[model samples]
Target: MELKKKLFPFFSTVGILIVVLGLYAFKSDSATTERYVAQTRWENLKVLPQNISKDSLDYLMKNYALSLGVKCTHCHVPSKTDPTKLDFASDEKIEKEIARGMVKMTNDLNALYFQPHFPEPKPKQVHVVNCVMCHRGAVNPEKYLSQMGEMYKTYDPNRDNRKEMFLEQQKKQ
Candidate 1:
């Protein structure tokens, strides 16, 4: 009766303190975890500029991942001994090779077309095509614009006859 009433408030306060401390511990541990540590260290970057800082590399990599609606592991293979550790230099994943081709294609497309017609000078330019132009934050774009997918499926980039075909089509029109 009296004991229950007296201890109830103390027990409740102690329980809440325990829970708060546990939550704080979890938050702190996660904040200092290996993923955060890895983000601070960079090595063996091949495609991007070798002089690029870790922060810039991380930002660009994150943007690419978000553009494609994928996680780091989508193009990276994790270390067998430490799952949190990624082999950034490894080309084990085919998606990584595809991404490189996409980057080159985007650069070529921008250089050949949009850059020339710029109303303003570049290093200032507009209407540049990036992954987001078609991807819209997806690996495979959503169905509303699936014609883009069909076009890509039927088109052969390596055939190198795109310019000829475009001119032929224009002549018909």
Candidate 2:
């Protein structure tokens, strides 16, 4: 019995050490795996930038706009070609209005829900949303089609004859 007791404690300590070491190894391996995945995605993005359809862009823009609680006109000027044009494209009027509205919304939400419950003197920092949040990687067609169906409605296959072109390209491949 005495021998068993001594051996039991030693075995328990060794088992715990093994588990800790295994977990450490697993965490290190996961980091390496994530790095490889990121590298692959970067390569794919470089090669496939042209394959990104307009529907995909619209979907990304819509989600990004929603996140910021603003409309598309905020970033893209209606019927304007050059985004840098200060008159309509980069109008300070629209930017200021959107910024003020966002600030007000964030303040209101924080004051109502976060500030009262928490003893923190300062209110929570307002999160300014952006495009890269959801569309971090290559465009997901299924998500794009579902989210921004309206943008794709006017996409006439006859205009570009992309269906025929795709078939010809596929046969060549």
Predicted model with the maximum lDDT: 1
Looking at candidate 2, what is the lDDT of residue 156? Answer: 49
Task: Encode model 1's per-residue lDDT on 26-117: one tens digit a residue.
Answer: 77555457555433334655556676677777887898899888999998999877888988778767677778777778877888888887
Error of 1 at 74 (Å): 0.1
Candidate 1 at residue 117, lDDT? 76
For each candidate, how many residue pairs have backbone atoms clashing (under 3 Å)?
Answer: 0, 0
**Range of the 10 consecutive residues with the lowest summed lDDT in candidate 2:** 38-47
lDDT agreement of model 2 with the native: 0.51
List TM-score per model, in order: 0.55, 0.23
In candidate 2, residue 59 scores what lDDT? 74
Cα lDDT of model 2 by residue, 50-83, tens digit: 4556566467546655654566565445445554
